[model samples]
Target: MHNEGKTKMIPFGDLSREYDDLSIEIDNTVAGLLKSGWFVLGKKVEEFEEVFADFIGKEVFAVGVGSGTEALHLALVASGVTHGDYVITVPNTAVPTVSAISFSGATPLFVDIDPDTYNIDTNKLRELVVIEKKRRGNKLKALIPVHLYGQSADMEPVLAIAREFNLTVIEDACQAHGAEYKGKRVGSFGDYACFSFYPSKNLGAYGDGGMITTKTPEQAHTLKMLRNYGQEKRYYHTIKGFNSRLDELQAAILLTKIKYLDTWNTRRRDIADFYNQNIKNKAITKPVEVSYGKHVFHLYVIRHPERDRLQAYLQNNDVQTVIHYPLSIHLQEAYKDLGYSQGDFPVAEKVAEEILSLPIFPQLRDKEAETVAELINSFS
Candidate 1:
C-alpha cells in the first residue's frame, strides 16, 4: 500500500499542532502567570475552577488537583469510600480509573461494558449491585461509571441503581470533557465527577492537571483541603490529605484553552463524522454514538477482528494508530490478586483485542483523515 511518492505521516495525536494554533494566547497566558509570582493553588486556579464548574453545570463546584488520578482519589475519600469497601467500575478502562479506586483503600470490582458504547453495561451493573449488596452488604460502597471515549454512560439507570443500593456515584469522566447525557453534562450526574487534564485529554492542560466537580458545597470544601495537605487555614491541618494541587501555570493555560473547548470538540466531531461516513470497510466497526447524548469524540476509535494487523498496515502506509487498551485492567498483572481470569469479563476481553484508535485530534486535517480512511479501506 505504499504510495509512488512518500505519503505524509498522520499522527494519532498532535498536541504540538494544537499549541501552535493557539500559541499566541497560550504564550500570553503563561507569560502573565510567570509574572504573577503566586503559582500553586492561586487565583488562577480558583478562576479556572469556577469557569470549569460553570461549564459542567450551574451550581457545580470544581476543584483543581495535580492529576486526574488525584481528582478521583480525593473525590472517593470525600465521598466516604474507605478500606474494606468494594467500588465497582468497568474492567476495560485505563488503569488509572481502577488505580483511583484502589487509592481510596477500597477493593475494585469488575463489570463488563456495553458492546456498542464501550461504557459500563447498566444492566450488569444492577445485577452486580444486587448480588454484592446481599453478599458484601453495605461494604459495597461506590460505583464509578466511566464515561469512556467521550460518551456518557447510561447515567439515569446508573444513578437510580446507586440510590437503590445506597452506593455513592463517582463519574470517571477523565475522557469526557463537555460530553453530555440527555442534555445534561456528565459531571452533574454523579456525587463527584473526576476529570484529567493530561496533555492529551479533551480539555488538556499544557502539563498534568485534574479537577473534581461536585454539587455539594461541603464536598467541594473538603476537596479543596484534601488537595492542599489537609490545610483548613494557613498552618492548620484538619484531616489526612495529600499534596495534589493544580499549579497556576497549568491553570492559566487551561483557562486559555477552555475558551476554545467547544470549537475544538466540534472539530473533533467533524473529523469523526468524516471517518464514520468514509471508512466503509465491512471488516471495520465504526464507533457508535448513542441517541441519548452528544459524544465529543475524544478518541475516534474503531474495531476490527484483526486489529493488530490493521494497525501495522496503517503504520506501514505512513498512518498512525493505537489500541485504546490492549489489555483490560482485570487481566493486568497489577490486579492479579483481584482473582479475575481470562473469561471473567467476556466483552471487555474481546473488545480489548479488537479496539483501535485512529488519528483524531482537533488539529488533524481533513486530508490526513481521508488518507487514514483510504489506508484502512486498502488494508487486506
Candidate 2:
C-alpha cells in the first residue's frame, strides 16, 4: 500500500540535483576558469587556500593538495613520519587514512573507536600508547584522530595523550568541515589537519580537491614543497616528493562552495535534529551528537539490529540508504598483512555490521525526511 503523495524515490545522496540547484552559479565559476586559461596551481588555488586558512582560524596556514589522501600523505611526511615509524589511527575510517600512513613509509597502528562517538577511543588510545611503547619501544610518532561523521573526536584527552607520548596529531577532518570541539575547530587543534573535497563531502568541490591546515609556517612550507615535487624554487627538487598539486579549477569551485559551507552544515544539523526527534523505533539506534562540540552531520548514520533488513525495507519504500562502511579497515584484504583478526576491534566490527547511513544532505526536504522517518517507524 503505497502512499499517493510520498511515492517518489529518495536517493541516499543526489549529487545531480545539487548541481542543478546551483547550475547557473557553478557554470559561471567554471566558465571563468576556462576563460582565464590558467589551470594549474595559480591565483585561484592561492586565494582559496588563504580563505580556507582564515576559515580554520588560529592563524593556521592551509596548503592545497591533489586529494585527501595526498593531504594526509603530505601531513605525515611534513611531521617527520619516515620509514618504520608508527602512526596510530582508528580502524573504522576510510582506507585512505591508513593508506596515507603506508604512503609515508610508516606503519599504521590501529585503535578501536568509541561506540558512542564513532571517533578514536581516547581511553583506548591512552592505554594502547603505554602497551605499544612496551611492545614496539618508542617508534610511534603520530596520532591521526578522524572527526568521523562530522563530530569532533574527544581531542582534549587525545591531545593530552599525544603531548605526553611526544606524538604528532594529524586530524583526519575529511568528514567534519565545520565541526567544532569545545568552541574550537577540529583542524586548529592538530599539528596538521587533512580535509577531502570529495563530491559528497560537506564542503565539496566540483571535482577532487584537498587541503592540509597547519599551525606552523614551516610545516605549511614543507607541505607546499611536498605537493609539488619538493621544489620551492623551479627545478630545485630539494627532496623526493609527489606531484600532488590542487588545480585552479577545483580551487575556484571550492571558493564558491566555501561561501555556502556554514549554511549547508547548519541545514545538515537541522535535518539530523528532525530525524533525532521523530524517529522512535526501539530496534534502531539513532546517531549521537555530543555536547562538547557542534556536529556538522556530514552523514546521518543510525544502527539497527537488523540493518540489512531495514535497508531493504527502505529500498522497497523508495527511500534509499547506505552503509558508511560495511567492513572495518583492519579486516579488509589490503591490510591482511597487518596481522589483525575478527575480534581484534570488536566495537568497530560490530558497528560495521549494524550501521546504516540515512539520506542526508543540505537539500533534503522536510517532507522527504518525514516520509523516510515514517517508513522507518512503520517497519516491523
Candidate 3:
C-alpha cells in the first residue's frame, strides 16, 4: 500500500520546471532583445558576464563560450599549455576533462583518484611531478583538478602542490556550483576556473553555455579576444582563433536564473543531508563532505559493492539512477595510445565499477528523499 504513494517516476535530473520558474523574466528579456534587434555578444551577454563574474568572486571577463568543453579549451590556451606538453589530471571524471587537454594540443597524463574523495589525489600528483621532472625535466606544465559531484577536490593540498612546482592549476569546476572550502568558493582558488552551463549542472543554462573565471587582466583579455576571432578591434585580427562565443539567448536565460542559484543550491544541500541521514545500508558508502568544505551536492553518489545489482534494484522500484561515468578516461577505447591497462590505476577502476549517482536535483519533491531512502534500506 505504501508503494502506491511513490511519485510517478524519479528522473536522474529533471528540468521541466526550469523554464516555468523564470518564464516571466525570460520572456521580458527576449522581447527586449527582439525590440533592440541586437543579438550575439549584445548587452545581455555583457551584463550577465559582469554579474556572473562577481557571483563567483573573481574578476572574470566572462567570455561566453559555446560549451563547457570550449571553456576548458580556451582556459588551457590562455594558461599557455603548449603543444605536446604534459598536463596532469585524474581519470575518474567526465570525458570533457581529457578532451580539453587534447583540444589544446597538450598530452593528458591520466592519474588515479582518492579512494574517498573521488578527486585527483594531490599526494600522488607530487610523485608524478617529481618523477616526470626527473625523467623528462621541464616537459610538464599544468594540473587540472575536477571538483566532481560538487565537492572541492581537496584544493588546499592541490593548491599547495601546484604553487610549489609553479604549475598552472585550471580547475574543472564544471560540476561544482556554489561549492566552497575553508569559507572560500571553488572558482576563486585556482589560476583559472572553468564552468559548464549544461542544463544538468547545479548552475545550468537553458542550453549549452560556459564561462571562465580568472583574476589576471591579461588572461581575461586574451580569453575575450580568443573567443571573438582574436580581434580586439572591428575587422582586425591579431592572431588566428576559432568561433566559440556564447550565444545571447543562453546568456539572457542564465542571467534570469542566476538570481536564485544560491537558494536552489541550499535545497540540493538539504536533500543530500536527508539522504545521508536516512539511507543506511552497510553495503553502501554514502558521499562524505570534508570537515572544511560546503558541498553543493550536484550529484548524491553512493559507492556500492554490488553496484550493478543496486542500480537494477532501484530501477525495479521505479527509482531512477545513473553512473556519472562507467569508464575511466585512460581505459576508454579511444585513448589506447595512453596504453593504460587494467590494474594501472586501481582506485579509478574501482570507482568506475562501484560509484552510482542517485536522483538529487534541487527541485526534488520533499517526499522523494524519504521514499528513496526507504527503498534503499529495503535493497538488501
Candidate 4:
C-alpha cells in the first residue's frame, strides 16, 4: 500500500540513492572502455591499481581479483599456504575469512576475539602460536587479522607475535577502506593486505571486486600470474591457477567511488561520533576504538543487555537494523565439525548474542541519526 516514489519505510542501507549519480559515471566510463575495446587486464585496471596502491602507501603491485574471497584465497596462495597447513584466525568473523582459507587448501585454526574490538585477540593469538609450535611441530605459517567492522585489529601485538613465529600477516581489510592504524593505512601494515569492494563497503564498486597488496615484487608477480591462469605470457602456463580477474567494469566503478572514499568514511566516523555522544541507554555499550587507528565505522555496532527488546522497539519505530553476525563461526553449521563446543570460545559466543548494527551509512542525514539516537534513548 506504500506509494511508488516515497522513501523506503526505513532503509537498512540505502545503496540505491548512491547509484543514481554513480550510474552516469559508470556509463560514461564503460562507453569509453567499449570504444577502446580493451576489456581484460587493461589500462583501467592498471590505473586503478596504481591509485589504490598509492592510497594504501604500498608499492604499485595489487592484483585485481574476482571478489574479496578470491583476493584472500590468492593472498594465502601467494604466501605459500597449502594443504595440511593451518592459518590462524578468529571465528567471530565473516564466512569469507574461513572460506578463503578453505579455498586455499588450508585449515583455518579458529581463535577467539577481544571483547571490545571484536577482532582476533592478539593475546590469544600468542597463546595459540605457542600451542601450535609444541603440538603441530611446525610454525602456523600465517596470521590473517581481519579489520572487522572497519576497525583495525590490535596489530602492534599481532605483528609482534607474527615476527616471533615468522608468520605472514595477511590483513583482511575488506571492510576497512581508508581505515588507518597509527596514521598508516590498514593495507600497508601487514605482509599482504586484502580489500573487498562489495557494494555496501565504505569504498564499493558497482559489483564484486577485490585486490591483493604485497610488499615484495616476487609475491606480486605470483599473484598476477595466479589470477590469470598462471601465465607470464599468453598460452604459456607456468603453474595452475584460477580465473579470478577483476572485470574492467567493476574497476572503473570502484575508481569513481574511490575518489569519494575518504569523504564518505569521514562521514561514517562523524555519525559514529554522534551516536556515541547522544544515545544514553544504560543497556547499550558503544563501540570502543583503539587510539592507534582511525575507525571507518563500516557498521556502528552497539551491544545491549536487552538487545532483543531493543531490536523489537526499533522495528516498531520503522527503523531497520541488523546483527553483523547472528552466529559465531564455531557454531555455524558449516564449521560444526571443527569439534568446537559452545563453551569453547566464550567471548565470541557471548558477543554473538549482544551485538546489534544500527543504520550508520555515510549518506544517512543528521536528523536521521538524531532520530535513531532519540528512539534508542526512548527504549530505556
Per-model lDDT:
0.92, 0.92, 0.86, 0.87
Q: Which sections of candidate 1 miss by over 4 Å? A: 1-5
- List model 1 lDDT by residue over 157-190, tens digit each: 9999999989999999999999999999989999
Task: Compare the candidates by TM-score and give the number of the best one.
Answer: 1
Which residue window of length 10 is worst by lDDT in model 3?
55-64
Question: Could you tell me the TM-score of candidate 3?
Answer: 0.96
Error of 4 at 175 (Å): 0.6
Clashes of 3: 1
Pairs in steric clash, model 4: none
Residue pairs whose backbone atoms clash in candidate 3: 64-246
- How well does each candidate superpose onto the true structure, as a TM-score? 0.98, 0.97, 0.96, 0.96
Per-residue CA lDDT of model 3 for 51-142, tens digit only, reads 88888885555567888899999888888887878889999889998998998998899778899889888888888888876765566888
Worst 10 residues of 4 by lDDT: 3-12
Q: In candidate 4, how many clashes are counted? A: 0
Evaluate model 1: give its lDDT. 0.92
Q: State each candidate's clash count.
A: 0, 0, 1, 0
- Please provide, for model 2 over 23-113, each residue's C-alpha lDDT reduced to its tens digit, 9 standing for 90 to 100: 8988999999999999999999999999999898957999999989999999999988899889999999988999999989899999999
Error of 3 at 165 (Å): 1.8
Regarding lDDT, does 2 or 4 come out ahead?
2
